[model samples]
Target: MWLSPALLLLCLSGSLSLTGPSSVTGTLGGSLSVQCQYEEEYQSYKKYWCRGQNEGTCDNIVETQGEAKEKNGRVSIRDHADRLTFIVTMENLTADDAGSYWCRVRKTWYLGFWSSGTSVQVKVSVSPEKAMMFLSSSSSVHLLLLVFLKLPLFLTLVGAVLWVNRPLKGPGGSQPDKEKPSRSAPSPGKPCPGIQPFRPDRRDLQTLDSRAGGQQSLDSGGT
Candidate 1:
């Protein structure tokens, strides 16, 4: 007398087959859309979007039975026979909208008890808060991404600096300089490289030698 959930779903899918994304996500205060595809034979049949876990007992939110496009408050349904698909759009999403939804078609009754035909289950997830501005602006998005990517390197450099400046526990108890000065002072008694030493001319040395020879001759003659 009672049919299981899986058998009921199988019976509903026999008449018409529907295909769509199993799950979708949207941010708070935003909009999301679901596209359902069906066979050409059922494209002319009425299509409806419902909200609930069970397709038979789900509450109908919007249907395209009378018009090609039907809208009910925040939800809208549109059927395109040429494309053999139906699209459901929901705007101003809130936390309450996050739940199981169904895209189904109105077909002949099965065993004089079932009413809906083909169906597909879709799960909607709504974010708790609106997305940040960085998600919308290209520059801001790239900047935030770059910061996240470079965070580890930045932390590593900070830690290295702290480790290098840590106090020494020996005699001085002072942290040593990480880098030494480029220029060092000259050592004592060493000439500072660029100056040249002085030297006497060759002509002065020759004149002194001649004077010494003449004095020696005069002393020998007097003796």
Candidate 2:
């Protein structure tokens, strides 16, 4: 008796579930493959597996078993005689290829068949190409951060310079002169030793008194 595609999918995918390695790592140009298995004998339902990296949507890679065949370039799927077992391959992977994969069972006629899922992880390992990209991008980010930080520092420095150069006011609020007084004072004249009041111009006092007396007598006689 021919089992309905839906019942077969449920048996292999839902009930049995495909068993496979969840993750694998390889280089950019390296050949990569993933494996999965189901408990029941496959009864002719189309089987397909998809790959999705980093939580992205799974993309169809391979198809086999009963009514199965669908895939994009770079992905291949093959099933063993047991029908539930599958081997998946991807080639020439870039960083974008890294992600999870799911093995699915479906009906060729309508979406009727039941389905199961298995994971696929294609990791393009460390290479100079990726390393260089990381360094250059990271360096640019740091440079931008430094430039932004310097703006505030530069403004602060400018403010300090203006503050130092600002003019000061005097006590009466007039503009103040900046010049300071010298430490040494001017010298005084030499001291004279015990000297009395000295008069350099000396005249005859009696002659001056006689002239004054004559003038006074003439004035008295006239009066």
Best by lDDT: 1
Compute each candidate's TM-score over C-alphas.
0.53, 0.39
Tens digits of per-residue lDDT for model 2, 1-223 = 9999997875555534545665577566555777766555444555666656542366666677443433458777766645556677777777677656666654343364643333334333423454567789999988887788877788889999999998988889898777876555434653354556554443667777889999999999999
Model 1 clashing-pair count: 0
Clashes of each: 0, 4
In candidate 1, stretches whose alpha carbon ends up further than 4 angstroms from where it belongs are 1-16, 109-116, 134-223
lDDT for 14 (candidate 2): 55
The lDDT of each candidate is 0.84, 0.62
TM-score of candidate 1 against the unseen true structure: 0.53
